[model samples]
Every structure is written in structure tokens, then in C-alpha cells.
Target: MLTIRPATSADAQVAYDIRREAVRHHCIGAYPAEQMLAWTAGTAEDGYASLMASHFYMGCIEGEPVATGMLDVNAREIGAIFVLPGYMQQGLGKQMLAFLEALARNLGLAQVNLDATLNAAAFYRQCGYVGEATALYHSPRGIDLACVPMTKVLV
Candidate 1:
């Protein structure tokens, strides 16, 4: 069973690890190796802790966190949705996304936006997100990643 809970500042490193692992394992063919390396090089201090204390959440199965997602309420954006490679193809990502979309609705948002990684665009599309043109997402950790700009209207 997957149980999701709000993450605290203490879970910063855990979130970071999950993101790194997911990107490294699942984003291989979508991005070049060097870009992926730069993207995942940073530690939790980069900003995971603050996000954890805000709207970050972890999805745990049998007490082990295997996925992460974040809802930027202020920006009306959904991001950081990642699942550990071992946990892929089990519908965890969809569950986490549905949870976040519900949260957006509760906040009175009519839509939510996200920058889907090249490898994840299809998945978001399958989840009912409409995609715009591909764009470069400049990561705070200093890497430019190709991403699809997507948005979903809550209905």
C-alpha cells in the first residue's frame, strides 16, 4: 500500500535521493548523460528542505519512501513528481498526481501547470495534461533541461 504524507524539513535528503535516483534511472534516453549528471549533482541543501516544509509529500510503501511530489500552491504548479525506479509502472506516479490535483482544487485553482521532463511528457499526457511546445527549464542547481510545458484543467 502507498501512504502519502506531508514531508518535514527532516525529509530533505530523502526527497533529494529519490529525485536523483528517479532521474538517473528513468531519464537515460531522454537526456544526455552529462546533463543528467549536472542535474542530479546537488545535495538536499539546494532547496529540498524548504520545499519539504511547505507543500512537499512523500509516498511510502511499507514504511519506505519510494516517490516524491510537490505542489507549489502559490504558483499553481505541480512539480517534483518522481518515483523510484524500482517502484515504476505500479501507478504510484498517477496516485501522487491525482493527490496533488485534488489539493489544487481544494485551493480553488482551476488548473495546474508543470514542466514535464522529456521522458515524462507522455506520462503527463496520458494523465490528461495538455502540452505546449518543448522548452528549456533552467534548474536552480545550474542545468538547462528540455521539458514539455503542460497544463491540466481541473474538472
Candidate 2:
């Protein structure tokens, strides 16, 4: 069984590892190698530590953290929902998304939005997010990646 819990600075490496695996393995079909590499290069342990400290970032753990999700209440956005490549297609992503949405509802958010990578936009759509437009997102190193802006209203 998978359990969701608050992530800490200590889990930074786990989060970083999962994001790297997911981006490297699953996103190749949608993005070129250079862009993918740039996106993956954007985060590190310190980045995740600040994310955990500022937002509602959670981990999905069985024996270890195999998935992570971030919900920024101030932005009302769902950020960086990722599952380890080996753990894909196991419904972990859906569960984390539901948890984020529920948190948004409880926080009095009327809607939640995300900048979904081209590779992940379909998955977000499957979870009820409507794609608004395709846009360019800049990486930390200033590489532009194609992304879809998506939103889902809380009912």
C-alpha cells in the first residue's frame, strides 16, 4: 500500500531522484534530449528543501518514496507531480493529484492550475484538468520547454 505524508528537507534526495528518473525515462517521447536534460538540471536537494518548506509537497511511500507532489496554495497551482519511472502506471500519480486537489478544496481554492509538460499534459487531463494553451517554460539554465497550461475547478 502507498501512504502519503509531508515531505521534509531530508527527503530532498529522494524527491530529486524520483523527478530525475521520471523526466529522463518518460519524457523522451515528447521532448528532445537537450530540453529534457535542461529541465532535469533545474532542481537539486536545496531546491526541494525550499519547496517543502514553502508549499504543500508530499511523498507517496510504500517502503520508500516513489512519488512526490507539490501544491502551492499561494499560487493555487499544482507543481511537479512526478512518480518514479519504475513505479509508473500504478495509479500513484492519480492518488497524489487527488490529495492535492483535496488540500486545495480545504484551503478555499476555487480552482487549481499547473504548467504541464507536453509529456505529462495527457495524464493531467485524465485527472480532470483542462488544457488551456501551449506555452514555453524556461529552465533554470534558460532552456525553453514546451508546456501546456491546465486547470481544474474544485467542485
Candidate 3:
């Protein structure tokens, strides 16, 4: 059985680990390898603390975090929707998205925005997100990466 639980302070490291793995290994984006190597998801000084500050969700099967994502109510955004490799094609991402969208609705956010990784554009499209714009985002160390901006209105 899959369990979607409220992320606690102890989960910060694990969530950060998942996010880092997705960015460095799984991502098929315009981000350069040089930039990817520098990604130290919240295990570092700056971003880890910030990540620890956000509201996050962890999807566990038998208590292992196989999928993770977050919703930032203050920013009206959904961030870091990722499923570990073995967990792919199992509808975990869609479940995470639906849960986050429901949270977004409850938070009074009319729309939720996220920067879709290049590989995930098709999936996000399948999930009913429309393109908002495209941009070159600077990853760690100012490495520029192509990102598709997308949004889904909750209304």
C-alpha cells in the first residue's frame, strides 16, 4: 500500500535526497552536467534550510519515500514533483499532483505554477497543465537550463 503523509522535520534530508537525485540523474533538461554536479539538495547550508522551511509531502511504500513533492501556499506553487526510477509508471506522480492540486484549492490558490523539467513536459500536459512561458533557469553555479513554465487553474 502507498501512503501519502505530511512531511515532518525529519524528512527534510530524505526529500532533499530525492530532489537531488531527480535533478542530477533523472532530469533530461537543458541543464548542463557542470551545474548538476553542484546540486546538493538541502544537504547544504543555504537551500537545505529553505527546503526545511517549506510544506512538503512524501509518498511512501512500506515507509520508504519513493515519491515527493511540495506545495508553497505563499507562492501559490507546486514544486519538486518527482518519483524515483523504480517507482515510475505507477501513477505516483499523478497521485502527488492531484493531492497537491487539492491542497492548492484548499489554500485558495486559483492556479498552481511549477517549472516543468524538460522530460516532464509531456506528463504535465497529460495532467492538464497549459504552458505559461519558457525560460532559461540558472541552476546551481549559474548554469542555465531550459525550463517550461506551466500552470493549472484549480477553478
Candidate 4:
């Protein structure tokens, strides 16, 4: 069984590691290896710490940090939803999504938004997030990635 709980700064490295695995192993088919590796390597402590401190970032796991995601509670923005390759089909991502959605509801957020990776567009759609737009994400280092901007308005 997987459990969802608040993530701490100490989990920064683990979250980064999970994000790296998700981008490489699961997203390699959609993005070039070089671009993916560079993107993953560029993310580290500073960003994750700030996110844990302010947002509703939660880690889901059976034993360890198998997945992590965050909700920008005020804006109801969901970010960095990742499930390690081996843990993908086991429903851990769903568990993490549930936590973020519940947090959004509890916070009285009227809507939630996310930029979904190519492979994850369908999943987000299934979760009731309509595709509001498509974007060419130009990384700070100039790597271009395709993303679908999605939104779900809550009652």
C-alpha cells in the first residue's frame, strides 16, 4: 500500500533522483537524451526546498520516496508529478494526484493547472484537466520541450 505525506527538505535529493528517472526512463521516447539529462541535472536543492516550504508538496511511497508532486495552494498549480519507472503502473501516481487534489479542495482553490509532458497528456485529460493550450517550453539552457498546458476547474 502507498501512503501520502508532506515532504521535507531532507527529501530533496530523493525527489531529484525520482524526477531524473521519470524524465529519462519514461520520457526518453518523447525527449532527446541529452536534453532530458541536462534538464534533470540542472534541478537540485534550492528549488525543491522552496517548494516544500510553501506549497502542498507531497511524497507518496510504499517504503521509500517513490513519487513526489506539489500543489501551489493559492493558485492550485500542480507541479513535478513523477513516479519512478518501476513504480509507474502500481497506482502510486494516482495516490499522489489524489493528495494534491484534496489539498486544493481543502485550500478552497477554484482551479488547478499544470503543464503536462507529452506522454502524460492523456493521463491529465483523464483526470478531468482539459487541454487549454500547447507550449514550446524553452529551457533556460535553450533545450526545447513540448508541453500541453491543462486546467481543471473545481467546484
- The RMSD of every model to the true structure, in order and in angstroms, is 0.8, 1.7, 2.4, 2.1
**Tens-digit lDDT track for model 3 on 53-129?**
67788899999998888898988878878787787889999999999999889878899888887778888999999
Off by over 4 Å in 2: 42-46
Which rank order by TM-score, best down to worst? 1, 2, 4, 3
Q: What tens-digit string does per-residue lDDT give for candidate 2 at 43-90?
A: 565355567665546555555888889888888998878888888998
Query: In model 1, how large is the Cα lDDT of residue 132?
Result: 65
- Could you estimate the TM-score for every candidate? 0.97, 0.91, 0.85, 0.88
Per-residue lDDT for 23-87 in model 4, tens only?
Answer: 88888778777767777875656365556665635455555778888887666688889988988
Whole-model lDDT for model 2 versus the true structure?
0.82
Q: Report lDDT per candidate.
A: 0.93, 0.82, 0.78, 0.78
- In candidate 1, where is summed lDDT lowest over 10 consecutive residues? 46-55
lDDT of 4 at 109: 82
Weakest lDDT window of 10 consecutive positions for candidate 3 = 40-49
